[model samples]
Target: MAWWMSSSRSEKGRFLFFVLPSLICWHIWKARNKAYYEGVQMRLGRICHDILIDMKGVVEVQFNQRLGVQTFLQLYEGTAHPPPCYSVQLVGWRVTEEGTLTLNTDGCSKGNPGVSGGGGILRDSLGLPLFVFSTYFGETSSLRAEVLALATRLRLCM
Candidate 1:
């Protein structure tokens, strides 16, 4: 019935501009109600879910083009547009000789908080593999593996 709603529904771009503000407002209102009535704070996960639900129709209409444009604009505004540049740089220069110390470590987890393994490879400066070691842990977190990797690397360095 309203003029904005009528134009919004008829024009694709207009519809997105009109609905976006309302969707944002609705999410805020719902979050307030959830906090006040249920005494539960909204988490990032829930907020993200609600935003996805609210934007579903608009996203379907625009097919991600407008969304991508919006993201690009945000980034552009946040940073001055810099000219694209490329450069070649050397890495791993220290690993040039056989006696040079080189360590590479990685961690793998079956699930986020499930079985985990941390492994590392030690090589001399010449890139010759000196040792490969792995450790398995039960009911561990990825963060734990990361910490263990750091600790193990330190021990090897010493």
Candidate 2:
């Protein structure tokens, strides 16, 4: 793993360096549970195919496109055709009305009922940050975390 991280020479290689290990571990854990609980036999080929499918799903979600599963497999096998070009969009904060501030908040969870957290920043009309906060919400759904984040930020306004 150390060698692989050190040898990654491209941005794509670096991105995969961080993503592949955890993804492989997750699949292996799922296979272990299925075998132990359901008496299902595990096959190396099946696991490999699953990993490819999972990676493809991730890429499709990120690129917001429905690409074929073989696209990701061919990438690792050194036989992939070039992917379609993606356009970049510029994003900026819209200035708030005078005398008012903007609060941007975000929240996330590890699993549906897993550990969660919420955070927010209070920014002025000119986009300067006035306050920032983050809090842990032991365990909750993603929707709950988001609601909690918004509520917490709203509390600050009140």
Candidate 3:
């Protein structure tokens, strides 16, 4: 079985293992095309740096996740192990000023085009919850769930 198919792989690792290569390759391909078609040239090191930065953005937007034990970034940085995990203190949502409401929403899926759900909380100025909801969409992508969650909240608020 492929490493990605193994049951032993952490979800974060599996995700990155599959996605990072594809994304990096795609980025390289696009850059190659840009160089050939548009007469743009970037140093090899610069191209690598851009691919790495883009990879970080891809990981960040996915729930701010990180690989548990190992990561490509470790190899890129020439480190055998990633830095130790740090304790974080999370604070609840707050409105910038009084009389305002904040909507915090997120969506996730077991797999792309697999079981998905959207969730959110409506909070008052002081972070008091006014309403909260989460609903599963039988078979869908996380992106669809994100849009659905915002749509649902819009209808509910009006």
Which candidate's TM-score is highest? 2
Worst 10 residues of 3 by lDDT: 74-83
The model with the greatest lDDT is 2
| Model 1, CA-based lDDT | 0.65
What is the lDDT of every predicted structure here? 0.65, 0.76, 0.70
- The digit string of per-residue lDDT tens for model 2 on 27-122 reads 898998999999998877788778888876765676576754374445453322233569999979888788788888999899998899999999
Reference-based TM-score of each model: 0.37, 0.44, 0.44
Cα deviation of 134, candidate 1, in Å: 0.6
- Candidate 3 C-alpha lDDT tens digits along 1-158: 24435454444455566676787787788888989999889467766777667666666677475533243455233322234578999985545698889888888778988898888888888888999998887788878888888887888789
Native-to-model Cα distance after best TM-score fit, residue 21 in candidate 1, in Å: 41
lDDT of 1 by residue, 1-158 (tens): 23333432324435455566787778888888999999989776676567655565466566553333334233223223233468998865354654557788887678888888788988877777889888876677898887887787778778
RMSD for each of the candidates: 14.7, 15.8, 18.4
Report the Cα lDDT for residue 34, model 3.
Answer: 89
